[model samples]
Target: MEDIPNYVAATFIAIVIAVLGFIYYAVNTATPGKKNLTSSLVVTILVGWIFFVCVQTFNGYFTNLSGIPRLPMFVGLTIVSIIILFIWPRTRAILMEMPITTLHYIHIVRVPVEMVLWWLAVSRAIPMDMTFEGSNLDIISGISAPFAAVFMVGSRSKSRIGATIWNLIALALLYNIVKTAIGYMPYYFTPTGGEVANLGVFYFPYVLLPTFIVPAVLFSHLVSLYQLIFKKDQPQF
Candidate 1:
């Protein structure tokens, strides 16, 4: 019974990954050249996560937050994934071609993610600051996503501009939450005995946030920004 919340959180994390994976598949398969790459990226994410769980690697690392504070493995994965998505011509093309509305709709997952984080916070699993009731304002982006997709996603200049502005706001919100999270961690330069520690996030299911969900969200936003900038001439329809 004590572990029920963990199970629930894990389930949500799985759903997040599954939904994002579906989007990735849809985007990749929408075009001729993007198919094979999906399997490889999916495999890499899963295998990397499997290794983390099997080794319980993060637990040890978190203890000495000053030594090398960040969850290097997951951070590396996210950075590499983002780099590939942005720098590789094939992936960049696929990202640019992915529907902006799809990207907006994908943010809806952040709403439930915020709920789960609040649940975890109430359980004392993580800091309150990570929740919407606290410093995390990312929920606004999620709650507004569907509306933005519906009303602000036309080929019209105003619509495109609206989407671009929304993306920028969402990016700022994400950055805030991320910085707040890291500050609460037992990391270098952070004072000891903060009001709430971020230990829970390093656990099995929660680790999925930094490893998978956050990265996916970042990728989506980046793709949106790229499309809004370089691909503006192409109609979103």
Candidate 2:
């Protein structure tokens, strides 16, 4: 629940995507048979996203976490990437299972989704001021939609649903950002303290909704994984 810059959100997501992509590209491009492209990309992007979050939080005030540095965190995660891909069994197994199309679709979702969310916040259509209330409904989809992908049934069509939703949200976010940039969008809520209360870094419930998005992703994935393990034939979509 700290003050976060819009650029930080976008840039952090970029960093996450870049790192994840690098790993996927390395493993999938080089290793054969084991690689599943979509999951690899999602993992790669999520790892990079951690860096984005770290920097955003450490750089901000009011949290009293100022002593912590940003670059070091990124460095650590970088090492983590190496270890995860090269040494960790769980990591290796997950990466090997990733599909090429899924990887492609994940990147498609995260980057634009973050951008779309920020654009809405900036436009004041969403509560850019970082309060827990008065957020735009469009902003909600930006977080929740890509999140649904995390819980996919691992069917071939999984990527399709995520990608379509991402595109729709991204376009909406783009439109919102443009509207804000033109000075027409309304800013309904501005926190007096400039603090995004109760939300995690670069996060706001009304604006970001971690509980909604993150939980949805986890629960969805868990259920999907369960079905896959239990011999159910749920379609990926």
Candidate 3:
């Protein structure tokens, strides 16, 4: 909070606008009966805002990995998960009626979570390795990022492959920009370093891109393309 001037006020205003905008979008685009856009918009904003303002607050440093403020995050997620459980007819019907597959679950969580993370990345609160500590945490994405790609390919969907591939390629391009901003790699690493650990290298997260995030994004889209070709846009009843 100290890092921000009047953090609470700024946060409140930002949230209000976002909520209003979401409501407008939902009201304008929601289908007539299936799920009211108004309601969906409310739920989405509630869940999303809670995650943004309460749950995932540590300035976006995933490595801060601390545990003090995660309750809001968990609670918001629980609420949203419950809503998904109830509203998604096909997925809901599957339970005993059938069974929702891992892929189904993935879409429910991944889509929102990734979108949020992306937003945070854009917001400096998350930091783009603007500092040493930040770069380190950012690197974690290097390993975990690829899982997104793996999931895309493994899902075996065809119709959506093109979209996913497009997304992956976009991520790669964005990652390079971020890496450069961080002063890592050929772009700039080791702003200062000595006695680097054996393999003790530390260009920090900025330089770790080749490691995780790059490929995950790349793979997700590639997988999407595959789906576009050989699979259905969504699951069959």
TM-score for each predicted model, relative to the true structure: 0.82, 0.28, 0.31
Off by over 4 Å in 1: 1-7, 33-66, 70-73, 154-158, 188-194
- lDDT by residue (14-90, candidate 1, tens digit) is 66666556565647554656556765675576666656653664455534456555575557767796887688887
TM-score of model number 3: 0.31
| 35: Cα error in model 2, Å | 20
RMSD of each: 3.4, 13.1, 12.8
Which ranking of candidates, highest lDDT first? Answer: 1, 2, 3
Weakest 10 consecutive residues of candidate 1 by summed lDDT = 54-63
Whole-model lDDT per candidate:
0.72, 0.41, 0.35
Q: Could you tell which candidate, 1 or 3, scores higher by TM-score?
A: 1
Residue 90 accuracy (lDDT) in model 2: 61
Give candidate 2's TM-score.
0.28
| Candidate 3 lowest-lDDT run of ten | 195-204
- What's the CA error at residue 11 for candidate 2, in Å? 18
Tell me the lDDT of candidate 3. Answer: 0.35
Q: Write the per-residue lDDT of candidate 2 for residues 1-237, one digit (tens) a residue.
A: 234456655654554445355445535643466556654765556545554555554565213424553323433454454454536666555444444233333333344444544654554434453221223333444355434445432343454455445545544643443333223212222344542322232332222223122322222233223223442232453
